[model samples]
Target: MIQRLNVNTEVLSTYIRNSNTPIEYLRQKLPNIDKFLKGELEPTFNQVYALSKLINIPTGLLLLKEPISASSLNVDFRTFNSELLSDISSELKDTIIEMQEKQEFLKEIVENECPFVGIFTFDDDYSDVILKAKELLGNEITRKRFDNYRKILGQLGIFIFLNGKYKDNTHRPLNLNEFRGFVLSDKKAPIIFINQLDSKTGQFFTLIHEFVHLLYGDSDLFDGEDSKKRSKTEAIINSITAEILVPKELISDMFDNQIDIRTSLDSLSRKFEVSKFVILRRLYDLSMLSRKDFMSLQNELEAEFKLIENIKKNSGGGNYHNNLLFRMDSNFFNHVNNAVQQNKITYTDAFGIVGVGYKGYKILSRGG
Candidate 1:
């Protein structure tokens, strides 16, 4: 005689919607899940727990009388191309939840010392915002590359995260069409999450774009091109971001130095240390390049990108520890390690948040 509990089907339904978990996946992960979901049959405790894990929700939450909706830490940023996002993938939603969980834990321990956060608004002139942020960043954005900017952001007490999969679950890779980056602004533990699956250049541009969201003290989910369409707030932040990456006067000056449009683009790319995509975007935005030509140039670049990806794919994935370290910001990782040392959080807690075991965590602690 097996005992089972009548879990709240309504709660389960709400969670499934929030998670975007596929019905087929649930069916495959749990036999007779349909009956459990339909309340036709009570779920065994084990079944309920398994279902909870499958949906990436806490097992106990299934018993709640009403479901508390997750914020997803983002406003519903709509665009003309909203049709493209018929649904946010479960994997991406899960990734956001994981990041928010880490932030929730870290906020209690982190210092709310960064002064640049929540300092700007869309009403302010974009140029003024760029001027102020650059004054503080002071050449970090100029001489700095991606990794350098990452460290600087960490120093500013922002949580930086980049991963192609959900919670290191390789089975669930993020979709770039859904979002290129996300940011949730906070006085303490502000978060910047980039989709590592995007082209290295794409990620770079997205980084600054999300930083703008952080500065405005707002939350955003940014998808390149799609996000640039019609949102007024997005437009202001993007305008600021363009200036931060490649100042109008500077790009204009640099543009005059080259001969052939194609040849000069490469030269400008090297000069600015930004991606050709970014250079083209800046040029197009400034009315320096035509959209048709820009699209043509971008297609050529995309073809080159595909070739590079295949070559890299043929090679093995890089060292696990290095990848893990790359995915988690040193700024955030150090706090976790320090918390362990201060006995504020157990190694177990650190390990869980960092998605590492004892050996991997030790390597991270040693600054690997």
Candidate 2:
């Protein structure tokens, strides 16, 4: 049987007319819609179905009284994958404590500063940037203290999120394991994510180092070793990250002309409360020690670490980093606590999400 059908092409016509885009641009990219206009495509519902899949748009919105601009809304799809963390075993899970700390640090940033829109508009002069932050924060935040690290991040719009547990075998990506921090970017909100499992001193340095990248509006993911390499831009930021942590002026006065790298390394390490290896790395950046000397010292530190590991194995409480997972999940606990306090979630539910029992929850809920 052959039948003739009359269609009301009004819905499609009205949408196309109201769109701000030019007819040609719409016609070329949106061929499905163009087909509908040409009367070549059958069943107008097919137009609606195809547009939704192609543009990640909703079908219902397209049928509205006023045609919507699909470009107005933006979604960020940045993903962080670290080959460095692939070998980490499941037993080394991240904890709630660390997660909370990371999140709290980020939440403070979101609340205090505007979202970092992009890296292209970042400031390059490191000294000026830190000086500005220092001036604004005053004594409440200083270069030497760990708290100052948190304050600096708060000033940036990066909100840190820590997930997984300490003994649960969770770790950062293998490639990024050396890197302490990373940044997220989209057309709208830009965020920085710092891996909290690194020691406080390491984390502090990474925070500042990554801040340097953000200032320059760099979009590449970086790790620790890359930061050590000297480039005109990186050199400036490295100096600032190091000097802000341990003022260069203070280092000059402390070392004098002794030229004893080991003694100076110890002195600076003790003074700044940073690891000897970190102090040495900074000193190398300052050109205080030759490359050969720095390598020698690094080897010594590695030996010492190996010896310590051996001792810990024999003495019990093996070399595994205790409280690692707990430290990572510090933020998760805060969320769970809020949920519990608001009566929106039960302790059982909280424990379930965290993969802990009520007993563990009781200890965690007390707050770090």
Candidate 3:
């Protein structure tokens, strides 16, 4: 006779509700789910294991007497609309946990040598914070800065990852509108993950925004919303990011004379290596653009950005290996490779840490 195990009905219900799986699907999988829920029948170990796999919950949790309550993530999701919180899928949560585990491993081995991870304090003024960040970055925002931003972050002992799709289901891509970036604050090993599906300029801004969260030692998610209507903490960080990217004095110098708004915006965007949205915000902030003109240009720029994004999506096929290296950060790759070379970790373990297979690892090893 097969031994039956008592499963917590409340925990099972809560897991199913929180997960992407449907109730009907669960009912189909466990034909006697109703009986189980009613406490009329106990679940077999196999049934419990299958339910765990389906809902992405640990089987051990189901065996508990009481329902397990999930701990809050300590992340503030900045959004105009609260509904976007629902988009935080199980895959995303699992990805974050996995990244944290990897970060812990790195911290254990390399924390002593890395001193820049928790250099900033929340008590520091935004101006001072920005200056220190730039000093650590080794340069101000420029046309080529994006290429080296990740390297700078890595040098500061911040691990950054870029992923467009859910780790478990590649078919379901992460929605950029829901969250552009998130930072997990740890003194020894802070981590930031950016949604690569966002526009390049948007990604740059998100990096800075998330970095600001790390500076304050706050774990949070930044949904690319209007900077004007930000929360108090977000407003402070947004102002800092703007000033760091486009200094008021520098922008004032650029707009000394009257010129075509469109032409000047294009020129300034290229010069500052930021989105037109950011450039326009600076201009509006400096009283350079009239409110009416600012609103008009903002709408125009957003439409154009969407069109360009759609065009790029249509023109597919990019180098997967190089892109992986970029998402993983070159400095991160170097650290992992160094660890492997020093026999601290095997190549297989390195591959797992880097989120690549043997062939992909070979390509990354070749610096492709």
Q: Write candidate 1's Cα lDDT for 99-130 as tens digits.
A: 76566556556656578888886667776788
Stretches > 4 Å off in candidate 1: 1-86, 140-144, 221-230, 310-313
Q: Estimate every model's Cα lDDT from 0 to 1.
A: 0.71, 0.48, 0.70
Measured against the true structure, the TM-scores of the candidates, in listed sequence, are: 0.73, 0.51, 0.72
Considering every candidate listed, which one attains the maximal TM-score? 1
Query: 1 or 3: which has the higher TM-score?
Result: 1
Indicate the worst ten consecutive residues by lDDT in candidate 2: 74-83
The TM-score measured for candidate 2 stands at 0.51
Write model 2 residue lDDT over 1-368, tens digit each, in one string.
Answer: 21111223454565555554466765576765666656566333234434433444333344333343433322111112121321222222122222322332233223234433333333445566667544533534234665555545544444343322242333522222334455443222234555554546655665655555555555342222342232444556556666666666666667644657777777778777677877888777777778998899899987985686467446632222334333324444565577578765466545544545665566666645
**Candidate 3 residue pairs that clash:** none
Worst 10 residues of 3 by lDDT: 74-83
Error of 2 at 32 (Å): 27
Report clash pairs, candidate 1. Answer: none
**Model 1 poorest ten-residue lDDT run:** 73-82
